[model samples]
Target: MTEALGTRTITAAVLVIGDEILSGRTKDKNVGHIAERLTEIGVDLREVRVVPDVEEEIVAALNGLRHRYTYVFTTGGIGPTHDDITADSVAKAFGVSIDVDPRARAMLLEYIAEKDLNEARLRMARIPAGADLIVNEVSKAPGFKIGNVIVMAGVPRIMHAMLEAVLPTLDTGPKMLSETILANAKEGDIAGPLREIAERFPGVSIGSYPFLSETGPNTNLVVRSRDPELLAKAAREVADMVAARQPAA
Candidate 1:
């Protein structure tokens, strides 16, 4: 999708790299975790895609996302197992050489005994050249960052830790601010008036959400913008619109 004109939108895309996720064997947790962290840091999550553990598929997704967005985050398939092909695919994506980095190996040794450091575990240390490490506090194994693409572990805890480590390094634009007004009227009733309010406020985004309770269907008008003043102005209009449509007590 095209970005709105004249807006400073710092966009990001998430590539979920694993077969188990697509097969429904393992549900995704990192996409939401990463998206939440990115939003807090003022990055807009523009797109999300889940690809199987195929090198070509991973490479294609990475290439497309890294160029299209400000940042590309991949979760899963970075473990020691054979299906953990995220690292290798990332290396091939950038056409860079992949080898066991001394820094990553040192971190792994801090948790693994010398005798237990097998070839499979060593695979976790293989990072692409000229890439920085994303620290994983949960496990000694680290993720890697090359260019705008950040590769993270599939495990939710590990991915969350790595995202926190990467957050401070991002270049953020204006933060998205939101104000919500709960309307006693149903969504169907307020949809027409809400559309008028939205057209009146070009710089602000107005959304209507419906939920059911003991009182039946009700609408929530959410106004989002980077400027607080603009958001406030739009929110007031939405509240007024909802009030006008509400039934008299």
Candidate 2:
């Protein structure tokens, strides 16, 4: 059944929320991970927003991104901490009631004795009604799915685990194909012709990843496309373009 459906282009947006992120107390790594993962799963990451813990900002960002993209994944602010407000903001965005879900409560109950599961811990159980849970094996506080949005934890390890638990349930498109050519050059020197090739192959995405080392300047030109043939075609053009600019050696 899955094979019958060929690869389809999908666009996605990510929302990273937390005061710590905004204040520069913690640097966010999830955005980079999600972008790569989406690309691997045949989804294009069109937009990313890092918002503070404020509810109004989160709700607005959520409503806008969910409407604009195929899927919206939010990381952070879903933990037991006092500042964890992603769930509440998402509930407001969907105009739903925030309450302790029976399923989530049950899951919490499994790990903690009833006497020990106090209101503070129950905070983790409060999910928007009618949303599916994303399992967190590292810490049993499950993430929730409301509409097209999947809200997960901020901690990298738990967030990755939750993603693993939920990713299988999602309908993924065709994997994107990529070809890379490494050359001894700087990005500025190659940016112009690369842009032209990118324009020529409108169906494919051409990106230049640059690095500096004792070996001298280097750049990896990456060509990505859903079509393998198109990716190869673009890659060849990029290599030719780079070679034309390379000094005699």
Candidate 3:
């Protein structure tokens, strides 16, 4: 669901496809890249799902994400291979026909010669009917955007480029403002105070993240809110809470 503050907040989901990702053979990187970029443009990344190459799984995920969020971004399985079933699965999800888009084929020709575009390589041109192409500056293969679903390549570089091309077409929402306070105390020391602060500021989201460094364990208290004023106030309260617990020196 789209988050609402003062303005309508646009939310999106990243569906990472391919069995390689689940198998640990290929770690998924597009989620973070897409999430950060989308946040910069005021889009909230609501959900992320990684599914295998199974067509049924892809279709089910597509239907769920597309309907749930303002926009759905799917990465992987659009390449030219037998396992690249994202295009066809997406078609079935939307009840549309899949065909070799002339536009996509034309784009591929710019990198691969017409005669050299073999059957496997030519599969890159297959797109769901009535979908627009997302420009791939890194690779000549184009991604497709149909309805609220945007399908892009799995490679981080290529996905990053495609996201850039599609940014202009999206409608963003209110930007989230955040503030971080480094608490010298351990996470356990700050949990009680953090929870109290969270209750005090219902509009602001306060999270306590703990990390172990070479020196010792520390807590990173982060406050986030759509309202900058609220965020600032909550952050100040958090700082005060941390200071109150310190022994007088």
TM-score of every prediction relative to native: 0.94, 0.90, 0.96
Please provide, for model 1 over 1-249, each residue's C-alpha lDDT reduced to its tens digit, 9 standing for 90 to 100.
223345678999999998889899999988888878777878999999999999999999899989999999999998999888899999999999999999999999999998999999999999999999988899889998999998888888888889889889889877888898998887887788889888888888888888887878887778988887888899998888777766787
Instruction: Name the lDDT of candidate 2.
Output: 0.86
- Residue 50 in model 2: shift from native, Å? 0.8
lDDT of 3 by residue, 160-197 (tens): 88989999889988888788999989999889878988
Candidate 3 or 1, higher TM-score: 3
Determine the C-alpha RMSD for candidate 1 after optimal superposition of all C-alphas: 2.1
Maximum-lDDT candidate: 3
Total colliding residue pairs, candidate 3: 0
Candidate 3: stretches off by over 4 Å: 1-5, 247-249
Q: What are the per-model numbers of colliding residue pairs?
A: 1, 0, 0
**Model 2 bad stretches (over 4 Å):** 1-7, 243-249
Q: What local lDDT score does residue 231 receive in model 2, on the 0 to 100 scale?
A: 76
